[model samples]
Structures are given as structure tokens and as C-alpha cells.
Target chain A: MNINFTLNKKSVTIDVDPMKRLLDILREDFRLLGTKESCGEGECGACTVLLDGKPVTSCLVNAVHIDGKEVMTSEGIAKEPIGKLLIDCFDETNAVQCGFCFPGFLVTSYHYVKTDGEKNLNKIKKALSGNICRCTGYQKIFESVMLACERKPLMNANER
Target chain B: MLDINCQYKSVEVSGKKEINMKFYKPKSLLELFETSEKIEGKKYFLAGGTDINVQIKNGMIKDEPIIFLNHLTELKNILQSDNHIIIGALTSFSEILESELLKNKLPFFQNSLKNFASPLIQTTATIGGNIANGSPTADIVPLLLILDAKLKLFSKSKLREVPISEFYLGYKKFILKRNEIIGAVLIPENAETGYETFYKKIGSRKALYIAKLAIAGLKKISNNKIEEIKLAVGSLNEYPRRLFKVEEYLKNKLVNEIDFADVEHFLQKEITPITDLRSDKEYRYRVCINLIRTFLNQ
Candidate 1:
């Protein structure tokens, strides 16, 4: 099966099995390894990706289902404003202890802030609830998410 | 930031495509049946891809010739007809949760929707998949049972509506045929809403826990009396079982004069739950009893 979709503001096509998970396609085919996978059974949100600007676990989303759907991965840090801000805040807040869960965490936070502009703490926590983090206690990650929201507008300016 | 258009045609399923495997997204059910008739190895109708993908990935499902169903716009709509609330089987839980008609008319269904995995899962999970999966824990099934939901199935150029009570045969089993796809769910309109309704799911923590034991009860309250009661519990038995004996005893009981002895006695005798990996039978049973008491008190 062949699928064509936009990635990081560019269009690319790939030929693969329809049943392959979008998670593997993004990593193996597109080489966007930043999208992490933990508890591949959708129980954990470590594989979250923004599907059409909403956070969803790419592990659960099949390659066939994403036919023409837009998928944003951690590799889009420079292209996507939230990605860049999240990266900087993650570094500053020392939330990168074992960074495996960083990609899913970043994508989830990005979708949350983008969709809900106001920095409501309660909503932010709810949005990031799906993505799980292993190291660097969630307090630091939550701080980083808050910090990213603060810097997102400026970082988005860089995109212009 | 990944925004893909749906206009691009669907590609084939990922596998050793040594054979001429086809990827068919029929816009209508007729076309779907035609494709299903011709499908070769391991045919599967894809909706939401929530459980199907997971099951396939886990190797629990090794044979499924995929048939994509999200493109069937006709199956993804919700409409109200003369006497029933018609929800296309493929209509998403999120759509149902957001539907004004569903919220206003079907509170039991709405309560079940609220406990659905999360915003992300709810976005793509469909009612059809819930019934088709037939897990003892399928949230929608028990709610549908309480609401007297009916299923409309289309296959072999014929259509049939099966009442929700008789829809599932067993665990991971349904009355569907080889070429059948759930067309729509016909829930009887005018369900009484004044009844004191209860929906309680005892899962690990919250968020994504499958119900260890979930209970849904509808008790008609009139002049401080329990006029009629319908109680159903899921993840308790092979499937969600109606506690008919309990309901039978509760009927016409004065709410204020309600003796805890009668309800508890009937509840203990009605449900036969099994211990599973999710929880122990003792916990489920005790929790359900507490729920019945709490609900009655409410």
C-alpha cells in the first residue's frame, strides 16, 4: 500500500503495508524517531502525535487510517512553534533526564496549548494526561509545558 | 501541524503484498458488501482503527483482509427519524457526546460516553466497534441494553434490526454474518428521563481503565416511590446482564420505606461475576452492592 501525506511542511509518499502502525512508519520510513513508543498497547500515551492538530497515539493510529491525515512529530521542532518552545523549556527545566517520553510529551503539550490559547493550568494538565513520562518527575515536565506556553508566541514569531 | 486531506485515495494494507490485495473504502453499504464478497484472506471492516490496529499489532489478530470504513460518510451520520434516534454505526463517540439530541434525550448513553477512554480515543471510537468487539467491558453495550437500543444490519442485499439485548452471542462474538456491517442503531425515542439513573464504573484509577465492573440503573421515581427500576451490570458476567430479579423486587417500592434488606438480598442473588485479571470477583461484587446502596440513597 502507498500513502502520501505532508510532513514538516513538505509532501512525501511511501509504499508500505496498510496494517503497519503510523508510529513505525514515522520512525522507520520517515526517520522521525522522536515519536516515542512505550506500552505500545495504547494504554500509555508515550507515542502521542498530533493528528490533524489533535494529539493522538500514533501507535494506535494505523498507517491506512492516516492516509491523507496530517501528522506532526517531534522532528518538526523547528517548523512548528510549540516544538521549538517545548525543546528549549525542556532543556531549561531539566526535564530531559531520560528523554524517551519527550516526543509524545512535546506533541501532546503542543496540541493542548495550540487548541486552547489561554494557559489554563487545569486544561493543560488534562491535555497532557494521555502522554506519560518516565523520568524527570511530571512536575518538571509540567513546568516545562507551562514555560513553553509562555514562550510559544515568541517562538512562533521565528516561524514567520 | 500534520494536516492531511482526505481527497487522496486510500492505499493498500501493509503486508507481504505478494498477492493482488485491494484497499476498498466503499462510500455506501452496497459497495461495501460487493467488496466484502470478493475479499480473500482475512477480511476486516475498519472503523476508527482503535481496537483493530491494536489487536493486529499485538499479534492477537493474524488474519484480517482489511476493509476501510471511515470514508463511508453515509454510515458516519446521526439522524432522528419518525420514532427512533438513528445513529449511524460508524458515528464517532465524540460526535455522539457532542450531539444535542443524544445529550438531551439519552442521558444513560451520555453518561457512558463521558467515561469513554479519553478525548483522543473518544474522537475515533465508534458505537459499532463497541458492539462488534463485544468485550464484557464494552461501555456502550450496557448503556444500550438499558436504553433498549436496536441495531440495523445490512448484508446480502437485506437489512435487519436486532434488539440490543440479543445482539451479542458471547465474548468477542456477535450475530453478524460474513458480509454484514452494522448500518445504524435505532434507539427507541421518548425514553423516560425522569427516572433516577445511575452509571458507575469501577476501573483502576480512572482515565483509561476498562471497567472492572460497571453498573447502569434506571429507577422511575414518583411521589417518593420507586415506580419501576431497570438495573444492568457490565464486566460482571459473560456480558452485561440485567438484574431482572433485583428490578422485579424493587418495583413499586415506596422510596422512603425502602428496606435495604430487599434490594441487597435480590442483588446478591442476581449477579454471578467471575474473577478476571482486571479485578477479583469479591471486589466487583462488594463494589456493586455499595453502588446499589449509594444509588438508592441518591
Candidate 2:
């Protein structure tokens, strides 16, 4: 089956099984390795990606679903201004440890900052609740998002 | 014979781990029914692919044709009729949560489902899939049962509407016929008016956790008497069901006069909780009783 879609702001097409997972398609076909697959199941957010501006577990999404849809992996998000700002905040706060789950966190947090961008701790906690991190106790991760939320307006102004 | 207009492709991924499956994307609902009627053997309707994808990866689903239905935009809508809100079967939970009509009219229903399976799953998980899966722990079932929702079952031959409460025959067994798909869920507008609504989903942590047991209730008290009441529980029985007998017993009775012991006995008869991986039967049963008591007593 041939599926055509916008991948990371680029229009691309692939010939693969429609049943093939979006996660596998990104990694194997496109070599977008930033999207990790910790749990082949949707339980873990390690495979999270933006499907038409909404965060979805790429592991659960099929190749057919992505046809004519916009998909932004962590790799694509990293190039955006908000994504860069989130990375800087995480770096400054030392939020990452093993970094295995950082890509998923980056995508989810990047979404929250881009959409809601609230500095409230409870909202940040709720927004990133799907992503799991066994290290750093999540305090620094929360701080990093909160810090990014606080600086998002300034970053946007600079971008303008 | 399958519709000639329907497009389908059979593909086998060549590798160490190979999967051979035929995929069909029907252009219209009529085409879906026509193509489905001609297919022999196992096939699945892929709507959000949240549950089906996991089942496939776990090797629970293989060698089955997956009919893609997510792209059927005609079935993805939230419209308000004169007396009801018709939610398309393919409408995702996230879409439901975002609907201003649902939020304004069925605030309790919308708010209670906020903690359902994390934000990520909610983005792609459809309400119809949840009910059709027919799991005892399906969070949406108990709420829908309490809302007195009706399912519009669609088929090529005819379309029929059935109350959700009567749709389930047994565990994972539904009255839905083969080739008939759930088209829309019709929820009566202002169904919760003049009643106090309560919903509680007991899970391990919160987000991304399956419900061990859940209870939804709507009680209308007038002049210190229970005017009307509807109650439903999930993960405590073979399927989520209304406590009809208990509701019958409590109607027109004074709240304070009702005996707690008798109510517990009635509840015990309706629900059959079992020990499972996520919860113990004893805990589920006891928590259900306590939650019911709390809902009524308050």
C-alpha cells in the first residue's frame, strides 16, 4: 500500500503495509529514531508524536491513519523555536538523567507549552501525566516546563 | 461479490518478523457494508486503532483483514437535535471532551471521563469502540447506561435504535448483529436535570490506569423522598449494567427510611465481582458498596 503524508514539515510517501505502525514507519523507513518505542503498547508515551497538531501514541497509530495527515516527531519538534526553548529549560534545570524517555517528554512538553503554556504546576503535571520518567523524581521536569512556560512569551517575541 | 469501487490492498512485510494482512478503505458507509458482506473469515473495523493496534502487537490479532473506518468523515460528528445530542460513533474521547454542547448539557458526563486512560489514548480512542469492545471495566459504559443513551445501529438492510442498557446480552456479547455497525449514540439532552449525578472510577493511580470498579448514579430527591433514581456499575459484573431492581426498590421511598443492609443485599445480587490482575474481588465489591452508600447518603 502506498501512503502519502507530511512528515516533519516535509511531504513524503511510502509503500508499506497499512497495518504497519507509525512508530516503525518513522524509525525503519524514515530513520526518525528520536521517537523511541519503550512499550510496543500505548501504555507508555515513549512513542508519542504529533498527528495533525495533537499528541498521539505513534505505536497505536497505523500507517493508513497517517495518510494525508501531518505528523511531527520529536526530531521535527526540536527544530521549532518552542521545542528549542523547552530543550534549553530542560538543560538548565538538569531535568534529564538516563535520557531514554527524554524524546517523548520533549514532544509532550513541547505540545503543552505550545498549546496551553500555563505556569501552573498542577496543569503541567496533568498535561505531562502520560509520559513516565523513572529518574530525576519528575521535580526538575516539572520545573523545566514551568520555566519554559514563563519564558515562552519572551521567546515568541524574539522570534517575531 | 464485493463492490468494484471499493479499493483494497493485500501486503506482506518481508523481514524476520513478517505480517501478511489485507487492508480495505471503504469510501462510504454503503461501500463498507457491501465490501464487508463479501469478505469471508476474520476481519476487524479499525476506527481509532487504539485497542486494535495493541491487540495486533500482542499477537492477539493476526491474518485478519483490517477495514479502516477512521477516515469515514460522515460518521465523525457531534450534532444536537431537538431533544438529544447525537454523537457519531467514531468521535474520539478528546473530541467529546472539547465539545461545548456536551460540556454545557452533560457536564458530569464530560467531567467524569476526563481521567479516562490518559490524554494520549483519549486523543485516538473512540466512544463507539469502548462500548463495542464490551469490557466490564469500560469507563464509558456505566456513564452511558446512566444517561439512558441509545445506540443507532447501522446496516445495509436497515437501521435500528436500541437502548444501550438492552444492547448487551452477556460478557462481551452484544445484541449487535454481524455487518451492523454502531452509527451514533443518542443521549437525551438535560437527562441529568433535577437529579444529583455522581461518578467514581477507582483505579491504581489515575491516568492510564484501567478501572478496577466504577459507579455512576443519578438521584432525584424531593420532599425527603427518593423521587427517582438510576444506578449503574462497571467491572463488578459480567458487563456494566444498571441496578434496575435496586432502583425499583428505592423509588418513592424516603431516603432515611431505606435500610442500608437491605440495599447491600440487593447490590450483592446484581453484581458479581471477581479477583483479577488489577484488583481483588473482595476489594471491588466492598468499594462498590461503600461508593453507593456514599452517593446515596450524601
Candidate 3:
């Protein structure tokens, strides 16, 4: 089956099995290996990716189902200004340890921050509850998101 | 974040012929019904694909003749009339959680929606899938049961409305025919107001965990007497069920006059709990009784 959709910001057309997972297609077909596949099941957010601007477990998403949709992975986030701010915050808070879970955490935090997530600690915790980070016990990751939310967008400064 | 040493397998089940599976995306309910009739071999109606994807990967279901219903615009809408609010079966939990109609009307259901899997899963898991999956631990089933919801099952030519209470026959079983698909769910307008409702989900964690034991109740008290009461409990039995015996016991009884011990004994007799990986029989029974007590007291 051929799937035509946007990967990150770019349109892509590829032929693959209709039942192949979006996670495997992103990694194997497109060579966008940044999105990790930790738990083959949807339990782990390691396979998290933005499907039509909503974070979903890529491992569970069928490539055929994503036809005519948009998918944004961690690689796409890193290319954006907000994504860069998230990375810096994660670094400053020392949230990046083993780094196995960093992409999922970063993608989830980016989606949360971009979607006007409340700065309230509890709300932030709840918003990021889907993504699990074994390292740093989540406190540092929460701190990173909080710190990221505090920073003004570099793009906004240019407008000012 | 483990190494990329994982082996990627085709979506085809082993020993099954790897024929190119045809995918059908129907635009309208009529088209869907017509398409379903023309299709041959095993057919699956795909909506959110959250549960079905997992089922396919686990090889619990074969991967062929999938008719994707997510594209059906008619099936993705929510319509409210004077007597009822009709929710399309493909309506996802995220949509339900964000629906102003649901929040303003059925707040208990909206609150129950919050306790479902997670933002990711909620974005993809449809209410139809939850009911169609017929899992004992389905988060939405108990609440729907108490609300007296009805399901509209559409076949090639006709539609049949079945009260949710009678929809489930047993574990992972439903009265739905193989050729029929759930079209929409109808909630009475009264489900929105004039009733005290309670929902409690005991899960392994706050999110992304299946319900260990869950309960939902709705009651109308008039002049210190119970006018009506509906109760549904899940995860402890083969299927979530409305406790008709309990509802009968509470009818016309004064709220303050009921005995907790007697109600607990009655509840124990109503539900048969089995020890499973999520919880043990004794624990489920005790916690369920406590939940019932809490609902009554509140």
C-alpha cells in the first residue's frame, strides 16, 4: 500500500504494508530513527509522535491510517525554536540522563508547552503523565518543562 | 530508547496468506453499510484503531479486509435533540472530553472520561470501540450502563437499538451480529441533570492503566425516599452489569434508613469476582462494597 502524508513539515509518499506500524515505517522506511520504540505496546511513550498535531503512540498507529495526515517526530521538534528551548531546559534541569526516554519526553513536553499547558505544577504533571522517564524520577523532567515554559520564545523577540 | 535491534514483522498473521489486504474508507453511513455488504472474507470496522491495532499486533485478530470507518463524517458527529443526545460511535474520548455539550450536560460522563487511559490513548480510542471491545474493565461501560444508554447497531439495510444493559452477553461477547456495526450511542436528556451520580475507578495507576474495579451510580431522592437508582459495577465480573437487585432494593427506601451491611451482602450475591492479574477476588469484593457504600453516603 502507498501512503501519502506529511512527515515533520515535508510531504512524503511511500509504499509499504497497510498494517505496518507508523513507528516502524518512520524508522525503517523514512530513516527517521529519532522516534524510539521501547515498549512495542502503547504503554511506553517512547514511541510517542505527533499525529495530526496530537501526540499518539506511533507503535500503535497503522501507517495506512495516517494517510493524508501529518506526523511530527522529535527530530522535527528539535528543528523548531520552541523545540530548541525545550532541549535547553531539559539540559539545564539535568533531565537528560540515560537519554533513552528523552525523545518521548521532549516531544510530549513540546506538545504540552505549545498547546498552552498551564504552568501550575500539578497540571503540568498531569499533562506529561503519558510519557514516562525512569531516569531523574520525573522531578527534573517536570522542572525542565517548567523552566522551558518560563523562557520567552526567541522568535517573539524578533517580532518585538 | 533501547537499541534498534528489534525485528519488524508484517501486520499479517502467521500461516495466513499474505494477500494484499484491501482498505475501504467509507464517507457516509449508507456507503459504509453498502460497502460492508459487498466485501468478502473477514471484515473489521476500524474507527480509532487504538484497541484494534494492539489486537492486530498481538495476533489476536487477523489483518485483512479492514473497512476504516474513521472517515465516515456522519459517524463522527454528535447531535443533540430535545429528548436525547446522539453521539456517533467513532467519537473519540478526546472529543468527548472537550465537548461543550458533554461537559455542560453529562458532567459525570465527562469526569469519567478524564479517568480513561491517557491523552494519547484518549485521542484515538473511540467510545464505540470501548463498548464493542466488550472488555470487563472498559472505563466508559459502567458509566454508560448507569446512564441507561442505548446503542444503535446498523446493518446493511436496518438499524436496531439495544439498551446497553442487554448488549453484552458475556466475557468479550456482545449481541451484535458480525455484519452489523455500532452506529451511535444515545443518552437520554435526563442523563444530563436531576440525578446524583458517582463514579470511582480503582486502577493500578492514575493513568494508562485498566480498571481493577470500577463503579458508577445515579440516584434521585424525593422527600427523603429514593425515587430511582441505577448502579453498574465493572472489572470484577465477566461483564460489567447493572445491579438490578440492588436497584430494586433501594427503590422507595429512605436514603438514611438503608443498612450498609445488608447492601454489602446483597452486592456480594449480585456480582461474582474472579481473581486475575489486576486484582484478587476478595480484594475486589471488599473494595466494591466500600465503593458502593461511598456512593450511598455521598
Candidate 2's C-alpha runs over 4 A off are: A158-160, B1-16
Error of 1 at B78 (Å): 2.5
Candidate 2 lDDT, B1-298, residue by residue in tens? 1112222222223324455566678889999998888788878898998888777766777767778899998889999999999999999999999999998898999998898888888999999999988888999999999999999999999999999999999988999888899999999998887789999988888578889999999999888889889999999888999999889888898888988788878887777776789889899888987887788789
Give a tens-digit lDDT track for model 3, residues A36-121. Answer: 97766788799899999988888778865798999999999998888888899899889888998889988888888888745668
Separate DockQ for every predicted complex: 0.29, 0.59, 0.49
TM-score of each model, paired residue for residue: 0.87, 0.95, 0.92
- Chain B superposition TM-score per model: 0.84, 0.93, 0.87
- Give per-residue CA lDDT, model 1, range B108-165, as digits (tens): 6775667677666776788888878778888887777777778999886799988877
- Best candidate, lDDT: 2
Each prediction's whole-model lDDT (CA): 0.75, 0.87, 0.82
The docking category that best describes candidate 1 is acceptable
Error of 3 at A145 (Å): 0.5
What is the Cα-based lDDT of residue A89 in candidate 1? 83
Local lDDT at B273 for model 2 = 76
